[model samples]
Target: MAPSPSSAAQHRHHSSLPTVSSAVSWLFLSLLFLYVVYYSTILFEPAPTFTTTTTTKTATDCQDISTIESNTTRVLRFDTELRHIAFGIAASSRLWRIRKEYLKLWWRRGETRGAVWLDKEVTTTENENLPDIHLSEDTSKFSYTNPNGDRSAIRISRVVSETLRLGMEDVRWFVMGDDDTIFIVENLVRILSKYDHNQFYYIGMTSESHFQNMLFSYGMAFGGGGFAISYPLAVELERMQDRCLQRYPGYYGSDDRMHACMAELNVPLTKEPGFHQNDVHGNLLGLLVAHPVTPLVSLHHLDVVDPIFPGMPRVQSIKHLLESAKYDSASIIQQSICYDKKREWSILVSYGFAIQIVRGILSPRELESPARTFLNWHKRLDYTAYAFNTRPVTRNPCQKPFVYYMSSTEYDKTREKIIGIYTLHRERYPYCKWKMESPEDIDTIVVLKKEDSSRWTKAPRKDCCRVLPATKNGTLYLWIGNCQTNEVIEL
Candidate 1:
């Protein structure tokens, strides 16, 4: 126990040499093991797979788990380009002339891909500014028992599988819609970009009417509004959908058929409010004015709804609305509420759509709900038919909104922002009995907004706005954008 200091130091030195030697030996072994692993991988690894959307490769086929895992990483849904999607539009030869006009509105001849599945064949010329046309496979074997439903549902339901069978190269998502469906392609791409193509996602929205959702599963994605299926999901659906269809022969429409098959696969719906089924008919003002704070992806049942801009042809009005979307689809019809403290007035701007000027200041909460300007799909059903919240139109003429539909939108080079100019819709509202000041004399409302797509991927909030009121003639100027820090909307 009482050793000399020199002796104790010598013992410590002896023990440290073995410790150092053992570490060096282990380090050498680790390096050697790593070297072997690296070389073995290089020598035995299978060449990387180059898969087209049609490739039949499976993870089970490969014994090299490391390579399989590495290859699967390439299948994620990020940075998806427009070329990666394929559209399956259900059409009929009888209505081809009219429906093709709708297709021409947004169909990019070379840039967009996929075909229109028609009930019968139609000849196409090189100059046809539309997608290729294909005849749907005869669905005589399928049964539809709904007394009011058409057998065409069977044909339309098969469009997705037939489209997938076409084996489009590099297709990440398969989008399905009706002949009359108007798709905003850029917004569709943006909406799909949020999902993972490697996983199964049935993305779309249900009907605007509660009765439709009640009859059909609330979880169903109405095909008329358009729904997207991931490539993997499409492949899985293609396998069992035909057999699955047999079990649901009584389905009312194509959407329910697809929904039933999706249910069989256990893939729940991924609802995107922007994909509007628009089951209601009549003026679309109330709905578009208070659209959910999301990109305008698609609009359905446009034929039944009145022209978006009063007095203009239905087609022309839609084209007019699209002018603003062309510049900024992400913010199209997005609602922004602002107040005029001086005038004690409330103004709501639905960019690229319409501007609402109320006679008196109204709370933002009340303005957020869409006014019951549109009738329910079934006229017998009252305001309660809407699946979403709605407010009844006021019998008081003073409270009625002085609406101005967007006449045009243009980018101001000097201002560095796109400006939307809305003009008064000439239909005279019930004369106001109240003795308060009104926007009746104001002929124009000009709104300025800078476009940014990234705002959608972040938290969803209504864009903040201020009433500039710097008017020239009868014009009112306002600017809307991301809110400033601690910005509050108040009187």
Candidate 2:
């Protein structure tokens, strides 16, 4: 078979073809092994997956369903109103009767939504203008080691969480307060509307006392003045607060515990000055007369402080102040400064509250500073303890202000303005020795006002006022409204 030349060439070609085919088969098997080794891990191993979680168990049924449609749905946004807030007011059986009156002042029976968490049951009058009452769950399982603090702190701390568990509909904010807390609801609605309820917000002010804030934290919202938690934050708190509270057995109060939980959740407090803890004692006239530029939201410890209006009872004085609030809530206790150039007089009008006239012209800086008319919470005589700047009552008797508290404020429909009549307080002061025309002779001040909270959306500014010409011999007139572009408050 190898002797013939053509047959030999064909046999040689056949042998080379077999060798080439054998090499191709070996390359194909090697490639198959390499592909199996490299790709088997990828084909059989697990892949990463994404998930959306909330502190809710109700959505478990919907977990398998695609979330695209739900996620892509339009978010509804609306202005925060009275109905959107759930007020969790902490009270005890011992103080319920007296404190319920304070609640009645602000609560509209059918309009407001919330429950008063009490330690024990209290009888409710029919058709009472108060929030529904509920007995707080026993908190004896939690430890409170602070010697001076009350164990009631545990139950109070759970009020927000308990309120969240109520499963309220369309709840945007969970507001917490003591039973004695006086809330200016209209102002609360106005201020809360400025924030986005969808985000986590711990909105409140710290204690007015520096010592109190230093002892606990400036970050803690003094619960007396009240604090607001966005619904999202409340829900998160409801999920873990029982465990959080158990961890902090040594915490002194509900507020500090709340601060600790917020810290754990990596949220910081947002301070607002309108919430006044009113930790100080005595007359609040000076504080009210020279309010910060912000709206007055809450006033606490009303029973401890003297009546806001001289010679009026605690409840009546609040009602007197609310008279103006009923007409123009955003402007209550809001300060405006202007001058009588002819008389060289400095005049201050605390809208819906009082009017103060001093004999000498003073700068805005001195006027804006709160006068030390009230004592500190500790009853310390030293003025340096205050958290904010304060001015001493003028030693010079003639320069001291002649005060006039608001006697009445009514909406003048025809005038399209509020006419507030501030009658002279006539508190006998050190008689003025220097010769000058006396504002004491002026029996009344009529404040003409136009709504000015339009400026609240931007940087908040104090409303501006101009001293109008005297309308009656014994009456002075002033007008308060938004500031003019070129106008400035100066001497």
Candidate 3:
């Protein structure tokens, strides 16, 4: 089998031919596969299907969703200056505290584009940071006094006329407010957008205090809460303000005089619920939580209302609350009324602030609920006392719940008791109750004892009270049995 070298070489070459052919075939196949893949990806691949489902919604759900959609869409994109809104701030020299704390913030924000009407010119080194100051003395010559000697009427009437005259040529809207008033500028603009600026419009809301509303005309907007006047209306007011002031000599306040003037103009007051003149004193939890479905345009009497958050000053609290609205405008504007029929509990939610729980029977009238005193964060108590009333129960109030906390004076006295109550029953009873002993004092503490337990154990301060012993239908029946009578009253 010993062959020559040339023949052996020829045989080795013949054997390598098959291996070369095999490599070539594999390379050709890989190239074909790559070509097919490339073509498939580029030209033959299926287009992505974007299938949108049409949800079958209930009547209530449809309404809510529609309202939300409308609100979201209504947010317009425009420059703030395009509105030509001017602020007419009625300020006194004696209210230095307000001028320093609140006015400074407004000035820094640079939203107020008008002047502060003062009794005398303020010559200060910090004048650069302040809004325009128009001295009352300069405008007083044209002013008319009330025959009944109402100084506020005389001053406000003059100021209104002066502000209108000052802003008539340059501004489209003239906004009037007291020194203490705080305005949500964006919200105000949006609110203004709803109505035509060219037309005569007088926009405002009723006072928070029922008594004040009764004393003054409910039809008239509270000046402290702020009001907006269209250019045409302001011009009309400027022409007739002096005459109206002479006619309404018996009017008690500036608001009444303005109302009388508007009535004479045959222009009806347009109510806007967002402008809150916090005329009521005590915790604003009930009123705020049950706020009407609208944007909160302004909050007056910050001094009267408790701090919006805990461990913070009133000014800081207000600033924080206003800032919160920027993050969730839709939530702030939308109706936040929620109810749970099964538990017989009605929940009122004020976005980024407070929640109120009341009996379902008191659904719409949540403000009048016996459990209205169960404010979660009106005051900074213990972490255990603060309950997260926001739906879906995400976290404990102690764990940085999505709400503003304000300082409360009663935190020290109630902290230990609330903590102990939460620690003892948190595992067994998820719900907590706060039964207010005295209606006048919102800070008054009441200890709720468990139905079965004989010991008088304090209940968690926030989200207090639970419905007991669920029925087959999942309806909770609370029985009220009097000691003197054998009959049991069930609710």
lDDT by residue for model 2 (277-351), tens: 898999998898889988789999999999999898888888788777877777888898999878889998888
For residue 409, model 3's alpha carbon misses the true position, in angstroms, by 25
Model 1 C-alpha lDDT per residue in residues 1-491, reported as the tens digit of each score: 89999999999999899999999999999999999999999999999987544223342101111121222332323656678889999998988887787888888877889999998877666787899899999888876787888999998998889999998899999999988899888778778877889899999999999999999989999999999999999999999988998898787899999999998999999999999888988999999999988888898888888888888887777778777787777788899999987777889889889999987888999998999899998965497798999998877778778898888888889988998888987777777777766787789988888865556656789999998857497888899999989999996
Please give each candidate's TM-score: 0.83, 0.83, 0.56
Mark the regions of model 3 whose C-alpha exceeds 4 Å error after superposition.
Answer: 1-83, 107-111, 127-129, 137-150, 167-170, 333-348, 355-491
User: Mind giving the per-residue lDDT tens digits that candidate 3 earns over 1-491?
Assistant: 89999999999999999999999999999999999999989897788886443444332210222121212322223322423688888887777445546765555334457778877555656555566778764434334444645465567655666877664356778888888887766567656766777789999987644455666777998888889888888889889887777775567777778888899999889998788777654555545654554666788787766775545688987766655444333334222333345544443434445433443333343332222322323243222332212122323322111221211211124432111010010122233343322111122112222111100011211122223353334122221111223422123
TM-score of 3: 0.56
Give lDDT for model 3. 0.54
Residue-level lDDT for 143 in candidate 3: 40
Please report how far candidate 3 places residue 284 from its true position, in Å.
1.1
